[model samples]
Target chain A: MTTAQHLAEQWPGERPEAARRLLLAAVDSFSSRGFHATTTRDIATAAGMSPAALYIHYPSKAALLAEISRHGHATTLALVEQAVAGEGDPRARMRELVEQFTAWHARGHTVGRIVNYELRALPEADFAEVAELRRRIEEAVKQLIEEGVAADLFSVAETRTAARAVTSLGIDVARWYNERSSESPEQLGSRYGDLVLRMLGAQVD
Target chain B: MTTAQHLAEQWPGERPEAARRLLLAAVDSFSSRGFHATTTRDIATAAGMSPAALYIHYPSKAALLAEISRHGHATTLALVEQAVAGEGDPRARMRELVEQFTAWHARGHTVGRIVNYELRALPEADFAEVAELRRRIEEAVKQLIEEGVAADLFSVAETRTAARAVTSLGIDVARWYNERSSESPEQLGSRYGDLVLRMLGAQVD
Candidate 1:
């Protein structure tokens, strides 16, 4: 399956049917309209439920957003972790890491955009948890760069800043990605991987 | 003066004080709260005016946002244009381009964040105009990269993609910048210039 299709399927969370509908509605609403602008009624309507039906699933819009944020971050963190799991040359590992990260952002841009851009809208408590997931994502990338440096495959002046830029190249993909755009998620992922490898002064194929 | 301070001073549009106050309020509201979530009432209250008073300045909240976007784009375009002007070496030109672009995003992040991220929020007509300005910005960068390649000073395989990535490195800076952050705008601009130069395979001094 295409990466975008995979992402589409992943959005069908493991909640009950009613709750899933509400969550899906929240995703659509929050992705297009800012979280603050979307009301419980709008979400309920989108999900084909009554206004109060939303209450049974989510207490408030913020709660709904929190659920979405947590789920998105957790899933993404899992993807990043999985991307880095296989053993290889550190350079190859970094390539896989950038490819997968970029693919996720391109394919799952709605949730990715919100997860990366809308942290302020999440309640403070949820923000902390989501931020932790983000930190781990950064650390995963950082560790790869550090490993590459130790292996002498990469010549980077500052591993931390280089890692951030590498990830930023992927994260910012969500900000511009659209299906109508020319590049496929896989193509974008591969291209960005090469560009980041270039930035690190790695031997680029 | 600091770039942020300079950006802060750039918000006073060619409007009357009341209108400028309304625009400033919109910038704060849109920056903190996503544009859709911020109501006319919120803007007016933030500006210390009644809800009805906003109509005297802007016909609608979207109009106010459009105004801010147009002004912001114009100023940034001017900056980008000037950065690429009077350049000696193509390498030096690219370095200056990245530096000034990064500084703009860092200092003008309050509005830059919105302008870069909230294109979907703009009306269709206004979006077209803003998009054209964006195209010009991208074209300018691409032209510079092309010039460097033609001169054999830079070795980028994909000039368009490389230019986009270079700009993205700076644009994404706005999403995470805070006054409390350790790196000042000038410092960040300098660092990013080096990084882009590195990505271009330019010899770093």
Candidate 2:
């Protein structure tokens, strides 16, 4: 799929067409101009609607951000959860997890940037909801590392720290990856998967 | 020194007192509220000056951000250069480089966040200047990995990818780190140092 196709897929199909357009426009504005910099009028104008029409779908600019943040976090959380549920030993699961996680961030980097970097811009209640999703995401990775250490497939001194490092490897890809980037998301993900496996001290294939 | 003291040291000592105050205030506001959201009036008030006074120090908000970006990039570039110049083989140098680099990010995360995440907010000319500094920083790490590979101290399939992974590990620290974090900069840096060594396939001490 094209980059634009991938970004459009991030929002749910169940939402109304107007709401979806507003969300997509918000993602573009928030990612490029940042959450604090982007105005509600800009988002409405980009969505080809009047400011009054935007309020019908989302009450405030912060509400629009909160919805976008919710969608992005939920999508990534499901991605990690699926990776964890896949068939494999700890080493295999980890490779799959890192590769898919890295590729997801790289492919949908616009949403990734907003989800990862703009959390602080979220309102207090909205931030708490997203934080819960993040905690679950981290726990899934940590559990995989714990399983690896138990099976003697990987040697790790601190599983929590190792999990953080592994996730950081993928999350930061969004910050740097772009059209000018040399590697495709798949190629970058593959390389990062191997590097993360090595970091975990697993046997490289 | 306290975190506040460490943050203050990021600005050069040679700058005049009022300019330094304006710069520090800008860092605090920009980092917290973000560059797009913060007003010159807010920065001036935070610095205990009128908005007119801020213009005397920085002609515009973008100019203030550019100055902060310049100082931050120069500081980190010098950091990597110093580590690369230190004693021992590539393994030892890589350890020192990751340790110090990671610690710097964790300790000065406020400035680190602005420097790393807010680059897109910079004007065209300023962005190009900071990009050059970033290129040099990446080259410094890549050279150390190349040295390690040549010396048979480290094993790597792709030198460039590995260097990016190593730097990403440290740079992401600024995103998650805060007072609530469990590890001190030193402790976190030591762990990351070992992880990078492992990722490089270097002999871990």
What DockQ does each prediction reach against the true complex?
Answer: 0.70, 0.86
lDDT of 2: 0.90
Please report the candidate that would top TM-score against the real structure: 2
Clashes of each: 0, 0
Candidate 1 C-alpha lDDT tens digits along B1-205: 4533454488645667788788888988888888987899999999899989999878899898888899888887788788778467888988888888888788887887888878888889999999999899888888888888888888887788788888788889888877776778888888788788878877544
Native contacts kept (model 1): 0.63
Can you tell me the DockQ of model 1?
A: 0.70
Residue pairs with backbone overlap in model 1: none
Off by over 4 Å in 1: A1-8, A203-205, B1-7, B12-14, B51-53, B203-205
- Report the lDDT tens digits of candidate 1 across residue range A1-205: 4433554486665668888778778888888787878888889999999988889878898898888789888887887787777778877888888888888888888777877788887889999998999899889888888888887888888777787788888888888877786788888888888778878888644
- Over B22-57, each residue of candidate 2 has an lDDT whose tens digit, in order, gives 988999999889898999999999999999988988
**Chain A vs native chain A, TM-score per candidate:** 0.93, 0.96
Q: State the weakest 10-residue window (summed lDDT) of model 2 chain A.
A: A1-10
